[model samples]
Target: MHIEVSGLYKKFGDFQAVTDVNFEIEKGQLIGLLGPSGGGKTSILRMLAGLESVDKGDIVFHGKRVNDLPPQERGIGFVFQNYALFKHMTVEGNIAFGLEVKKWSKAKIKDRVAELVELTGLSGFEKRYPHQLSGGQRQRVAFARALAPEPQLLLLDEPFAAIDAKIRHELRSWLRDMIDRLGITSIFVTHDQDEAIEVADQIMIINKGRLEQKGTPWEIYKNPQSPFVAEFIGESTIVEDASSLRGFGNASDWPGTKALIRPEYVEVGKPSDFKLLSATESGRVRHVHFRGSEWLVEVEVGSTRLVTYRSLEKEIVHPGDEVQVLIHRAYLFNNNDSWIMENKLKEDPMPVHI
Candidate 1:
């Protein structure tokens, strides 16, 4: 089912939690509500699920307005971050609880529970209690319980936040597969950028009680509409001073504009390596830290500290080594923080003397 949120607003006493938030989810699309803590992401989800009343605006499902409907009447399944499983109940009991509440016949509930058990990979653990299963297993049980009702829309609030890092990664892939197979319209809340990027068909970024941007992960990362979206979606360095562009490029066209440089777009090497370097900046390496498969090198160029990610397979440089930093690409934004253009410094690029 398609969902549309128009001019949605929510308030908690004196502070407004959501301000004119609006977005639409296409049928069977698994979208992600991504933001930091207390950024109104959960509030928006709650409002959509009918857990919270809408202070303003309409939430339309398919073609009907669900603003006045209760959560149970909305035909929406919700999964909580903590799993919210019944500790004393076995896996089968938990999964069947929703069906039982809906007054399903014993035979039908039994058949549905069995089907979900196999689908969620919890067939063998059906007789086990919540405490007996691992974190990932418990999460699967939660999903099974939520899906038992066969709701048209699925809402998950930080579904994998409680799982271990390794298990979370596995569950993300599994959940995406399950949702697609079921063809359910799903909206999940997460503070994890990687999770949203890896799972969702579309992502809605929320900050300061406002909808920052909405797009596919690639669009949001590569062509951010604003500086906040650019920095929040990925690693970026904000260049404020025009002098910093000396070795980077000519900022004359966009005077007083701020530039965003992504760590991966930067290249660090010996000064002699870049024969036709358009722009080159010299900086003292402040620190070098290992980031699993890559090295994050921090360099201090005057008062600005820039970070660049280098592959571990490449030549490694130590701290305090003076290196020439090459900018292969950059995103410039006007004073209003609106994106101007993405400058690719590789072909017919700006020239900078090394």
Candidate 2:
């Protein structure tokens, strides 16, 4: 079902948890509410699930106001981060709990639980207790229990936070596939940027109890609307003055603006290899870190420190090495931190001949 949150606000005593947050979710879309801890993301999710009261605003589910409706009346299936499964109950019993609460026939509950067990890949573990199952297995039981009731919406709060990294990766792909097959409208909250980008059809970024930005992963990464969004979404170098750079033109007309340069767009190499002296800056490498398949080199150019990512196949520079940095692309923002223009260098930096 389509969900609309308009002018939503939530307060705790004197502190406000959410401030005038607004967004909409299309039916059957898997969206993510992404933000750091204590940023009001959980508060927003709780409010949507009817677990928390709304201080002010309207939460409309398919044109019907659900502000006063209880969670069960809202037709939402919620899965908590800790699994929240019954320790003494078997998997089948846990899956059947929701249906039982709704007063479904004993035969119907059995059928539904069987269907969910198979769908969630827990076919042979129906009799296993929560403590007897692995982390991934317990997560499956939680998901199955949440889905057994066939609710109109599914809400997952950091569903994979407790699983190991390897299993978490596997479950993300599996869950997306299962949700799509069932055509369930789902919203999951997460602080992991990579997880949100990889899992959600759309992402809403929240910070300090305010909605910073909302868009597809690509859009949010490529064209951030504000400085906070740009910095939070990816690694960026903040250039306080464009005129200070070698090739950039005079910026007297544009005062009090800055430029954001991504690491991927910066080239680090020997000074002899640079063809355009105007676009290059010399800096001493402060540190070098091995990042799985690549290297992250930190360089000190004057008072500013810049980070550049280089492939492992390239020549690795060590700390204290004097290197030249070239910029190929940058996004300019005004004093208000709104995007002003994109600067793409006319000539690509000449490749370093190894």
Candidate 3:
């Protein structure tokens, strides 16, 4: 009851979106595959689900290689982001469609359809068409249809993006619980960081077709292996002075493996004499965006812009007021720009240009 993918590669002409990706999922584990739009998250999922062919790779399930198996023969469930329901069919018809295609007995199909509708909370809406249901209901129908087939692995491709915000949250929770109860191994692909963090048991982040970092949500967020993964996963603003930090190494090409830190984690009001260029700059507030409980304050320290999230209770700075910014920390990168940790948390956050 496990799934393994090794050395997956996909290229459209010269674009190698997924390169040498390898990972395995145990039975009943929910894996969150996260990355930017072009990072090849979908490509990897498609390859596993037999939707997209791979240039080279091995996909195995339960100790048997299944890379060449077609979607139906592989016994995998696939739910697309777009719902993809037949507009002419009722909710009951949609769920029963897959079972019917498999040539299951009519009585068995009826029983399974009833059970799925109940599990997905689509009981009352079974008579309704896709157009008549809310976005969440439609998504539930999609889930029921996929589950009715009883797949070895479920592949979800951003299933909740089209739903409204409130419903998206509820559906994510519901879907996670439902999948867990079923004890089914699943791979969820999403471009939204928050959604990935909220739903996935284990997150695998990829950048430009390469595995950047894979771990628990808290682990990857606190310790990113690449600047692209860090910035892609949260509200990140790169401060230029990170180049000279002790372990940051000599700056040659790419931004020294980014000193990745979230805006909320930054500490303000440190003394200006910290000896870092960012600490010494007297910058004026440029713009401020209210983010409910916190304010996303944008400050210009000379030519570079640093974004910080401050508690709302503090007096908001005006556009012209000069403010001191202290960059207490950063990290080092190899010549190729892969992120590496340098300073410890207790260490200074103020930037020290080596």
Candidate 4:
């Protein structure tokens, strides 16, 4: 609990895995380490769990330096992506393994195992072997085993990666509620943006072995500090020479050269029903895709392709049909900084500054 990582660095031979990554986690908070593969998410997590030696810097748990602490001594409960269950052991035996290793009395281990079984919703399945259980059930067993020792911090490396899409979606809420009820400070590593946003109390975006940004999911999405985050967080289309877009400011007035448009910020409709008609741009429909709940329409405005959702309530438009596209807002970003650019027609009509 109350974990702080400072000047953290890790390398493997010639490759730098994590570079000067720093962040803090308050007690009882759930943090998501989100990034692309090989972006140092797992490396930083391994270091926090004391499984990897820190090439530089300090890891403090509750103000005590844990840099030299061994993995067993760090009081961390780890759940791997594969579940890592014992094929030969039953659910009860697997859950009790850590307690058994700690040399707890037989009666105490039995009671503890029973409690964990019920808590993880595996009460009646305790007698089943790993292969006998479903993927989700096996993962519950893994979580139960890790939590048996009552560790101070819980670390999950892509806990739901092995589960199928439907179960993974269901388990996201289940795991989140369970962790909240247990009040254990937890960190989970995930490359899936939707999973991180849906589950974590806060998210740390890692990129190319660096800590790119850290904030609540809404903050990271609505206000990206860098170009990578803007492109990485959502379904965004990058527009070059954004100043050419109607109602957007001149290129020379803003520091950023490019604008990022999110699907939600775009509206596509017939010229008759659209709002802010003056700010609307003429675009030709390029493609349309069904997305279960709604249609994903691709509209081409000049050289840039803009994507937006077509509500089921609206009349369907075929490819090659001309339509009016209204962009409510866009994120303008360059190498060093980013800015939120509201459509001038939707704003106070002042000259655009950024």
Task: Residues 68-120, candidate 3: write the lDDT tens digits.
Answer: 88887988888988989989999999999989999999999999999999999
Q: How far is candidate 2 from the true structure (C-alpha RMSD, Å)?
A: 3.3
Ten contiguous residues with the weakest lDDT in model 2: 337-346
Q: Provide the overall lDDT of each model, using Cα atoms, as 2-decimal numbers.
A: 0.87, 0.87, 0.78, 0.91
How well is each residue in 89-183 modelled by candidate 4, as lDDT tens digits? 99999999999999999999999999999898997898899999999999889999999999999999999998999999999999999999999
TM-score (C-alpha) between model 1 and the true structure: 0.93
Residues 1-354, candidate 2: write the lDDT tens digits.
Answer: 899999999999988899999999999999988888889988998898999999999999999999999998999999999999999999999999999999999999988998999899998899989999999999999999999999999999999999999999999999999999999999999999999999999999998899999999999998888787888887878988865655555444578767777887678899777776656788889999999989998888777778889889888799999998877666777766565342334365566678
Q: Who is ahead in lDDT, 1 or 3? A: 1
Q: What's the lDDT of the predicted structure labeled candidate 1?
A: 0.87
lDDT of 1 by residue, 1-354 (tens): 989899999999999999999888899999998988999999999998999999999999998999999998999999988988999999999999999999999999999999999999887888999999998998999999999999999999999999999989989999999998999999999999999999999999999889999999999998888777888887878888543564445665667877787898677888887764556778789999999989999887778778899889878899999988776667777766565443344455555678
Steric clash pairs (candidate 1): 278-352
lDDT of 4 at 280: 89
List CA RMSD, all candidates: 2.9, 3.3, 4.7, 2.9
For model 4, what is the alpha-carbon lDDT of residue 158?
91
Report the candidate with higher TM-score, 1 versus 3. 1
- Taking all chains together, each candidate's TM-score versus the true structure is 0.93, 0.93, 0.85, 0.96
Best by lDDT: 4
Better of 2 and 4 by lDDT: 4
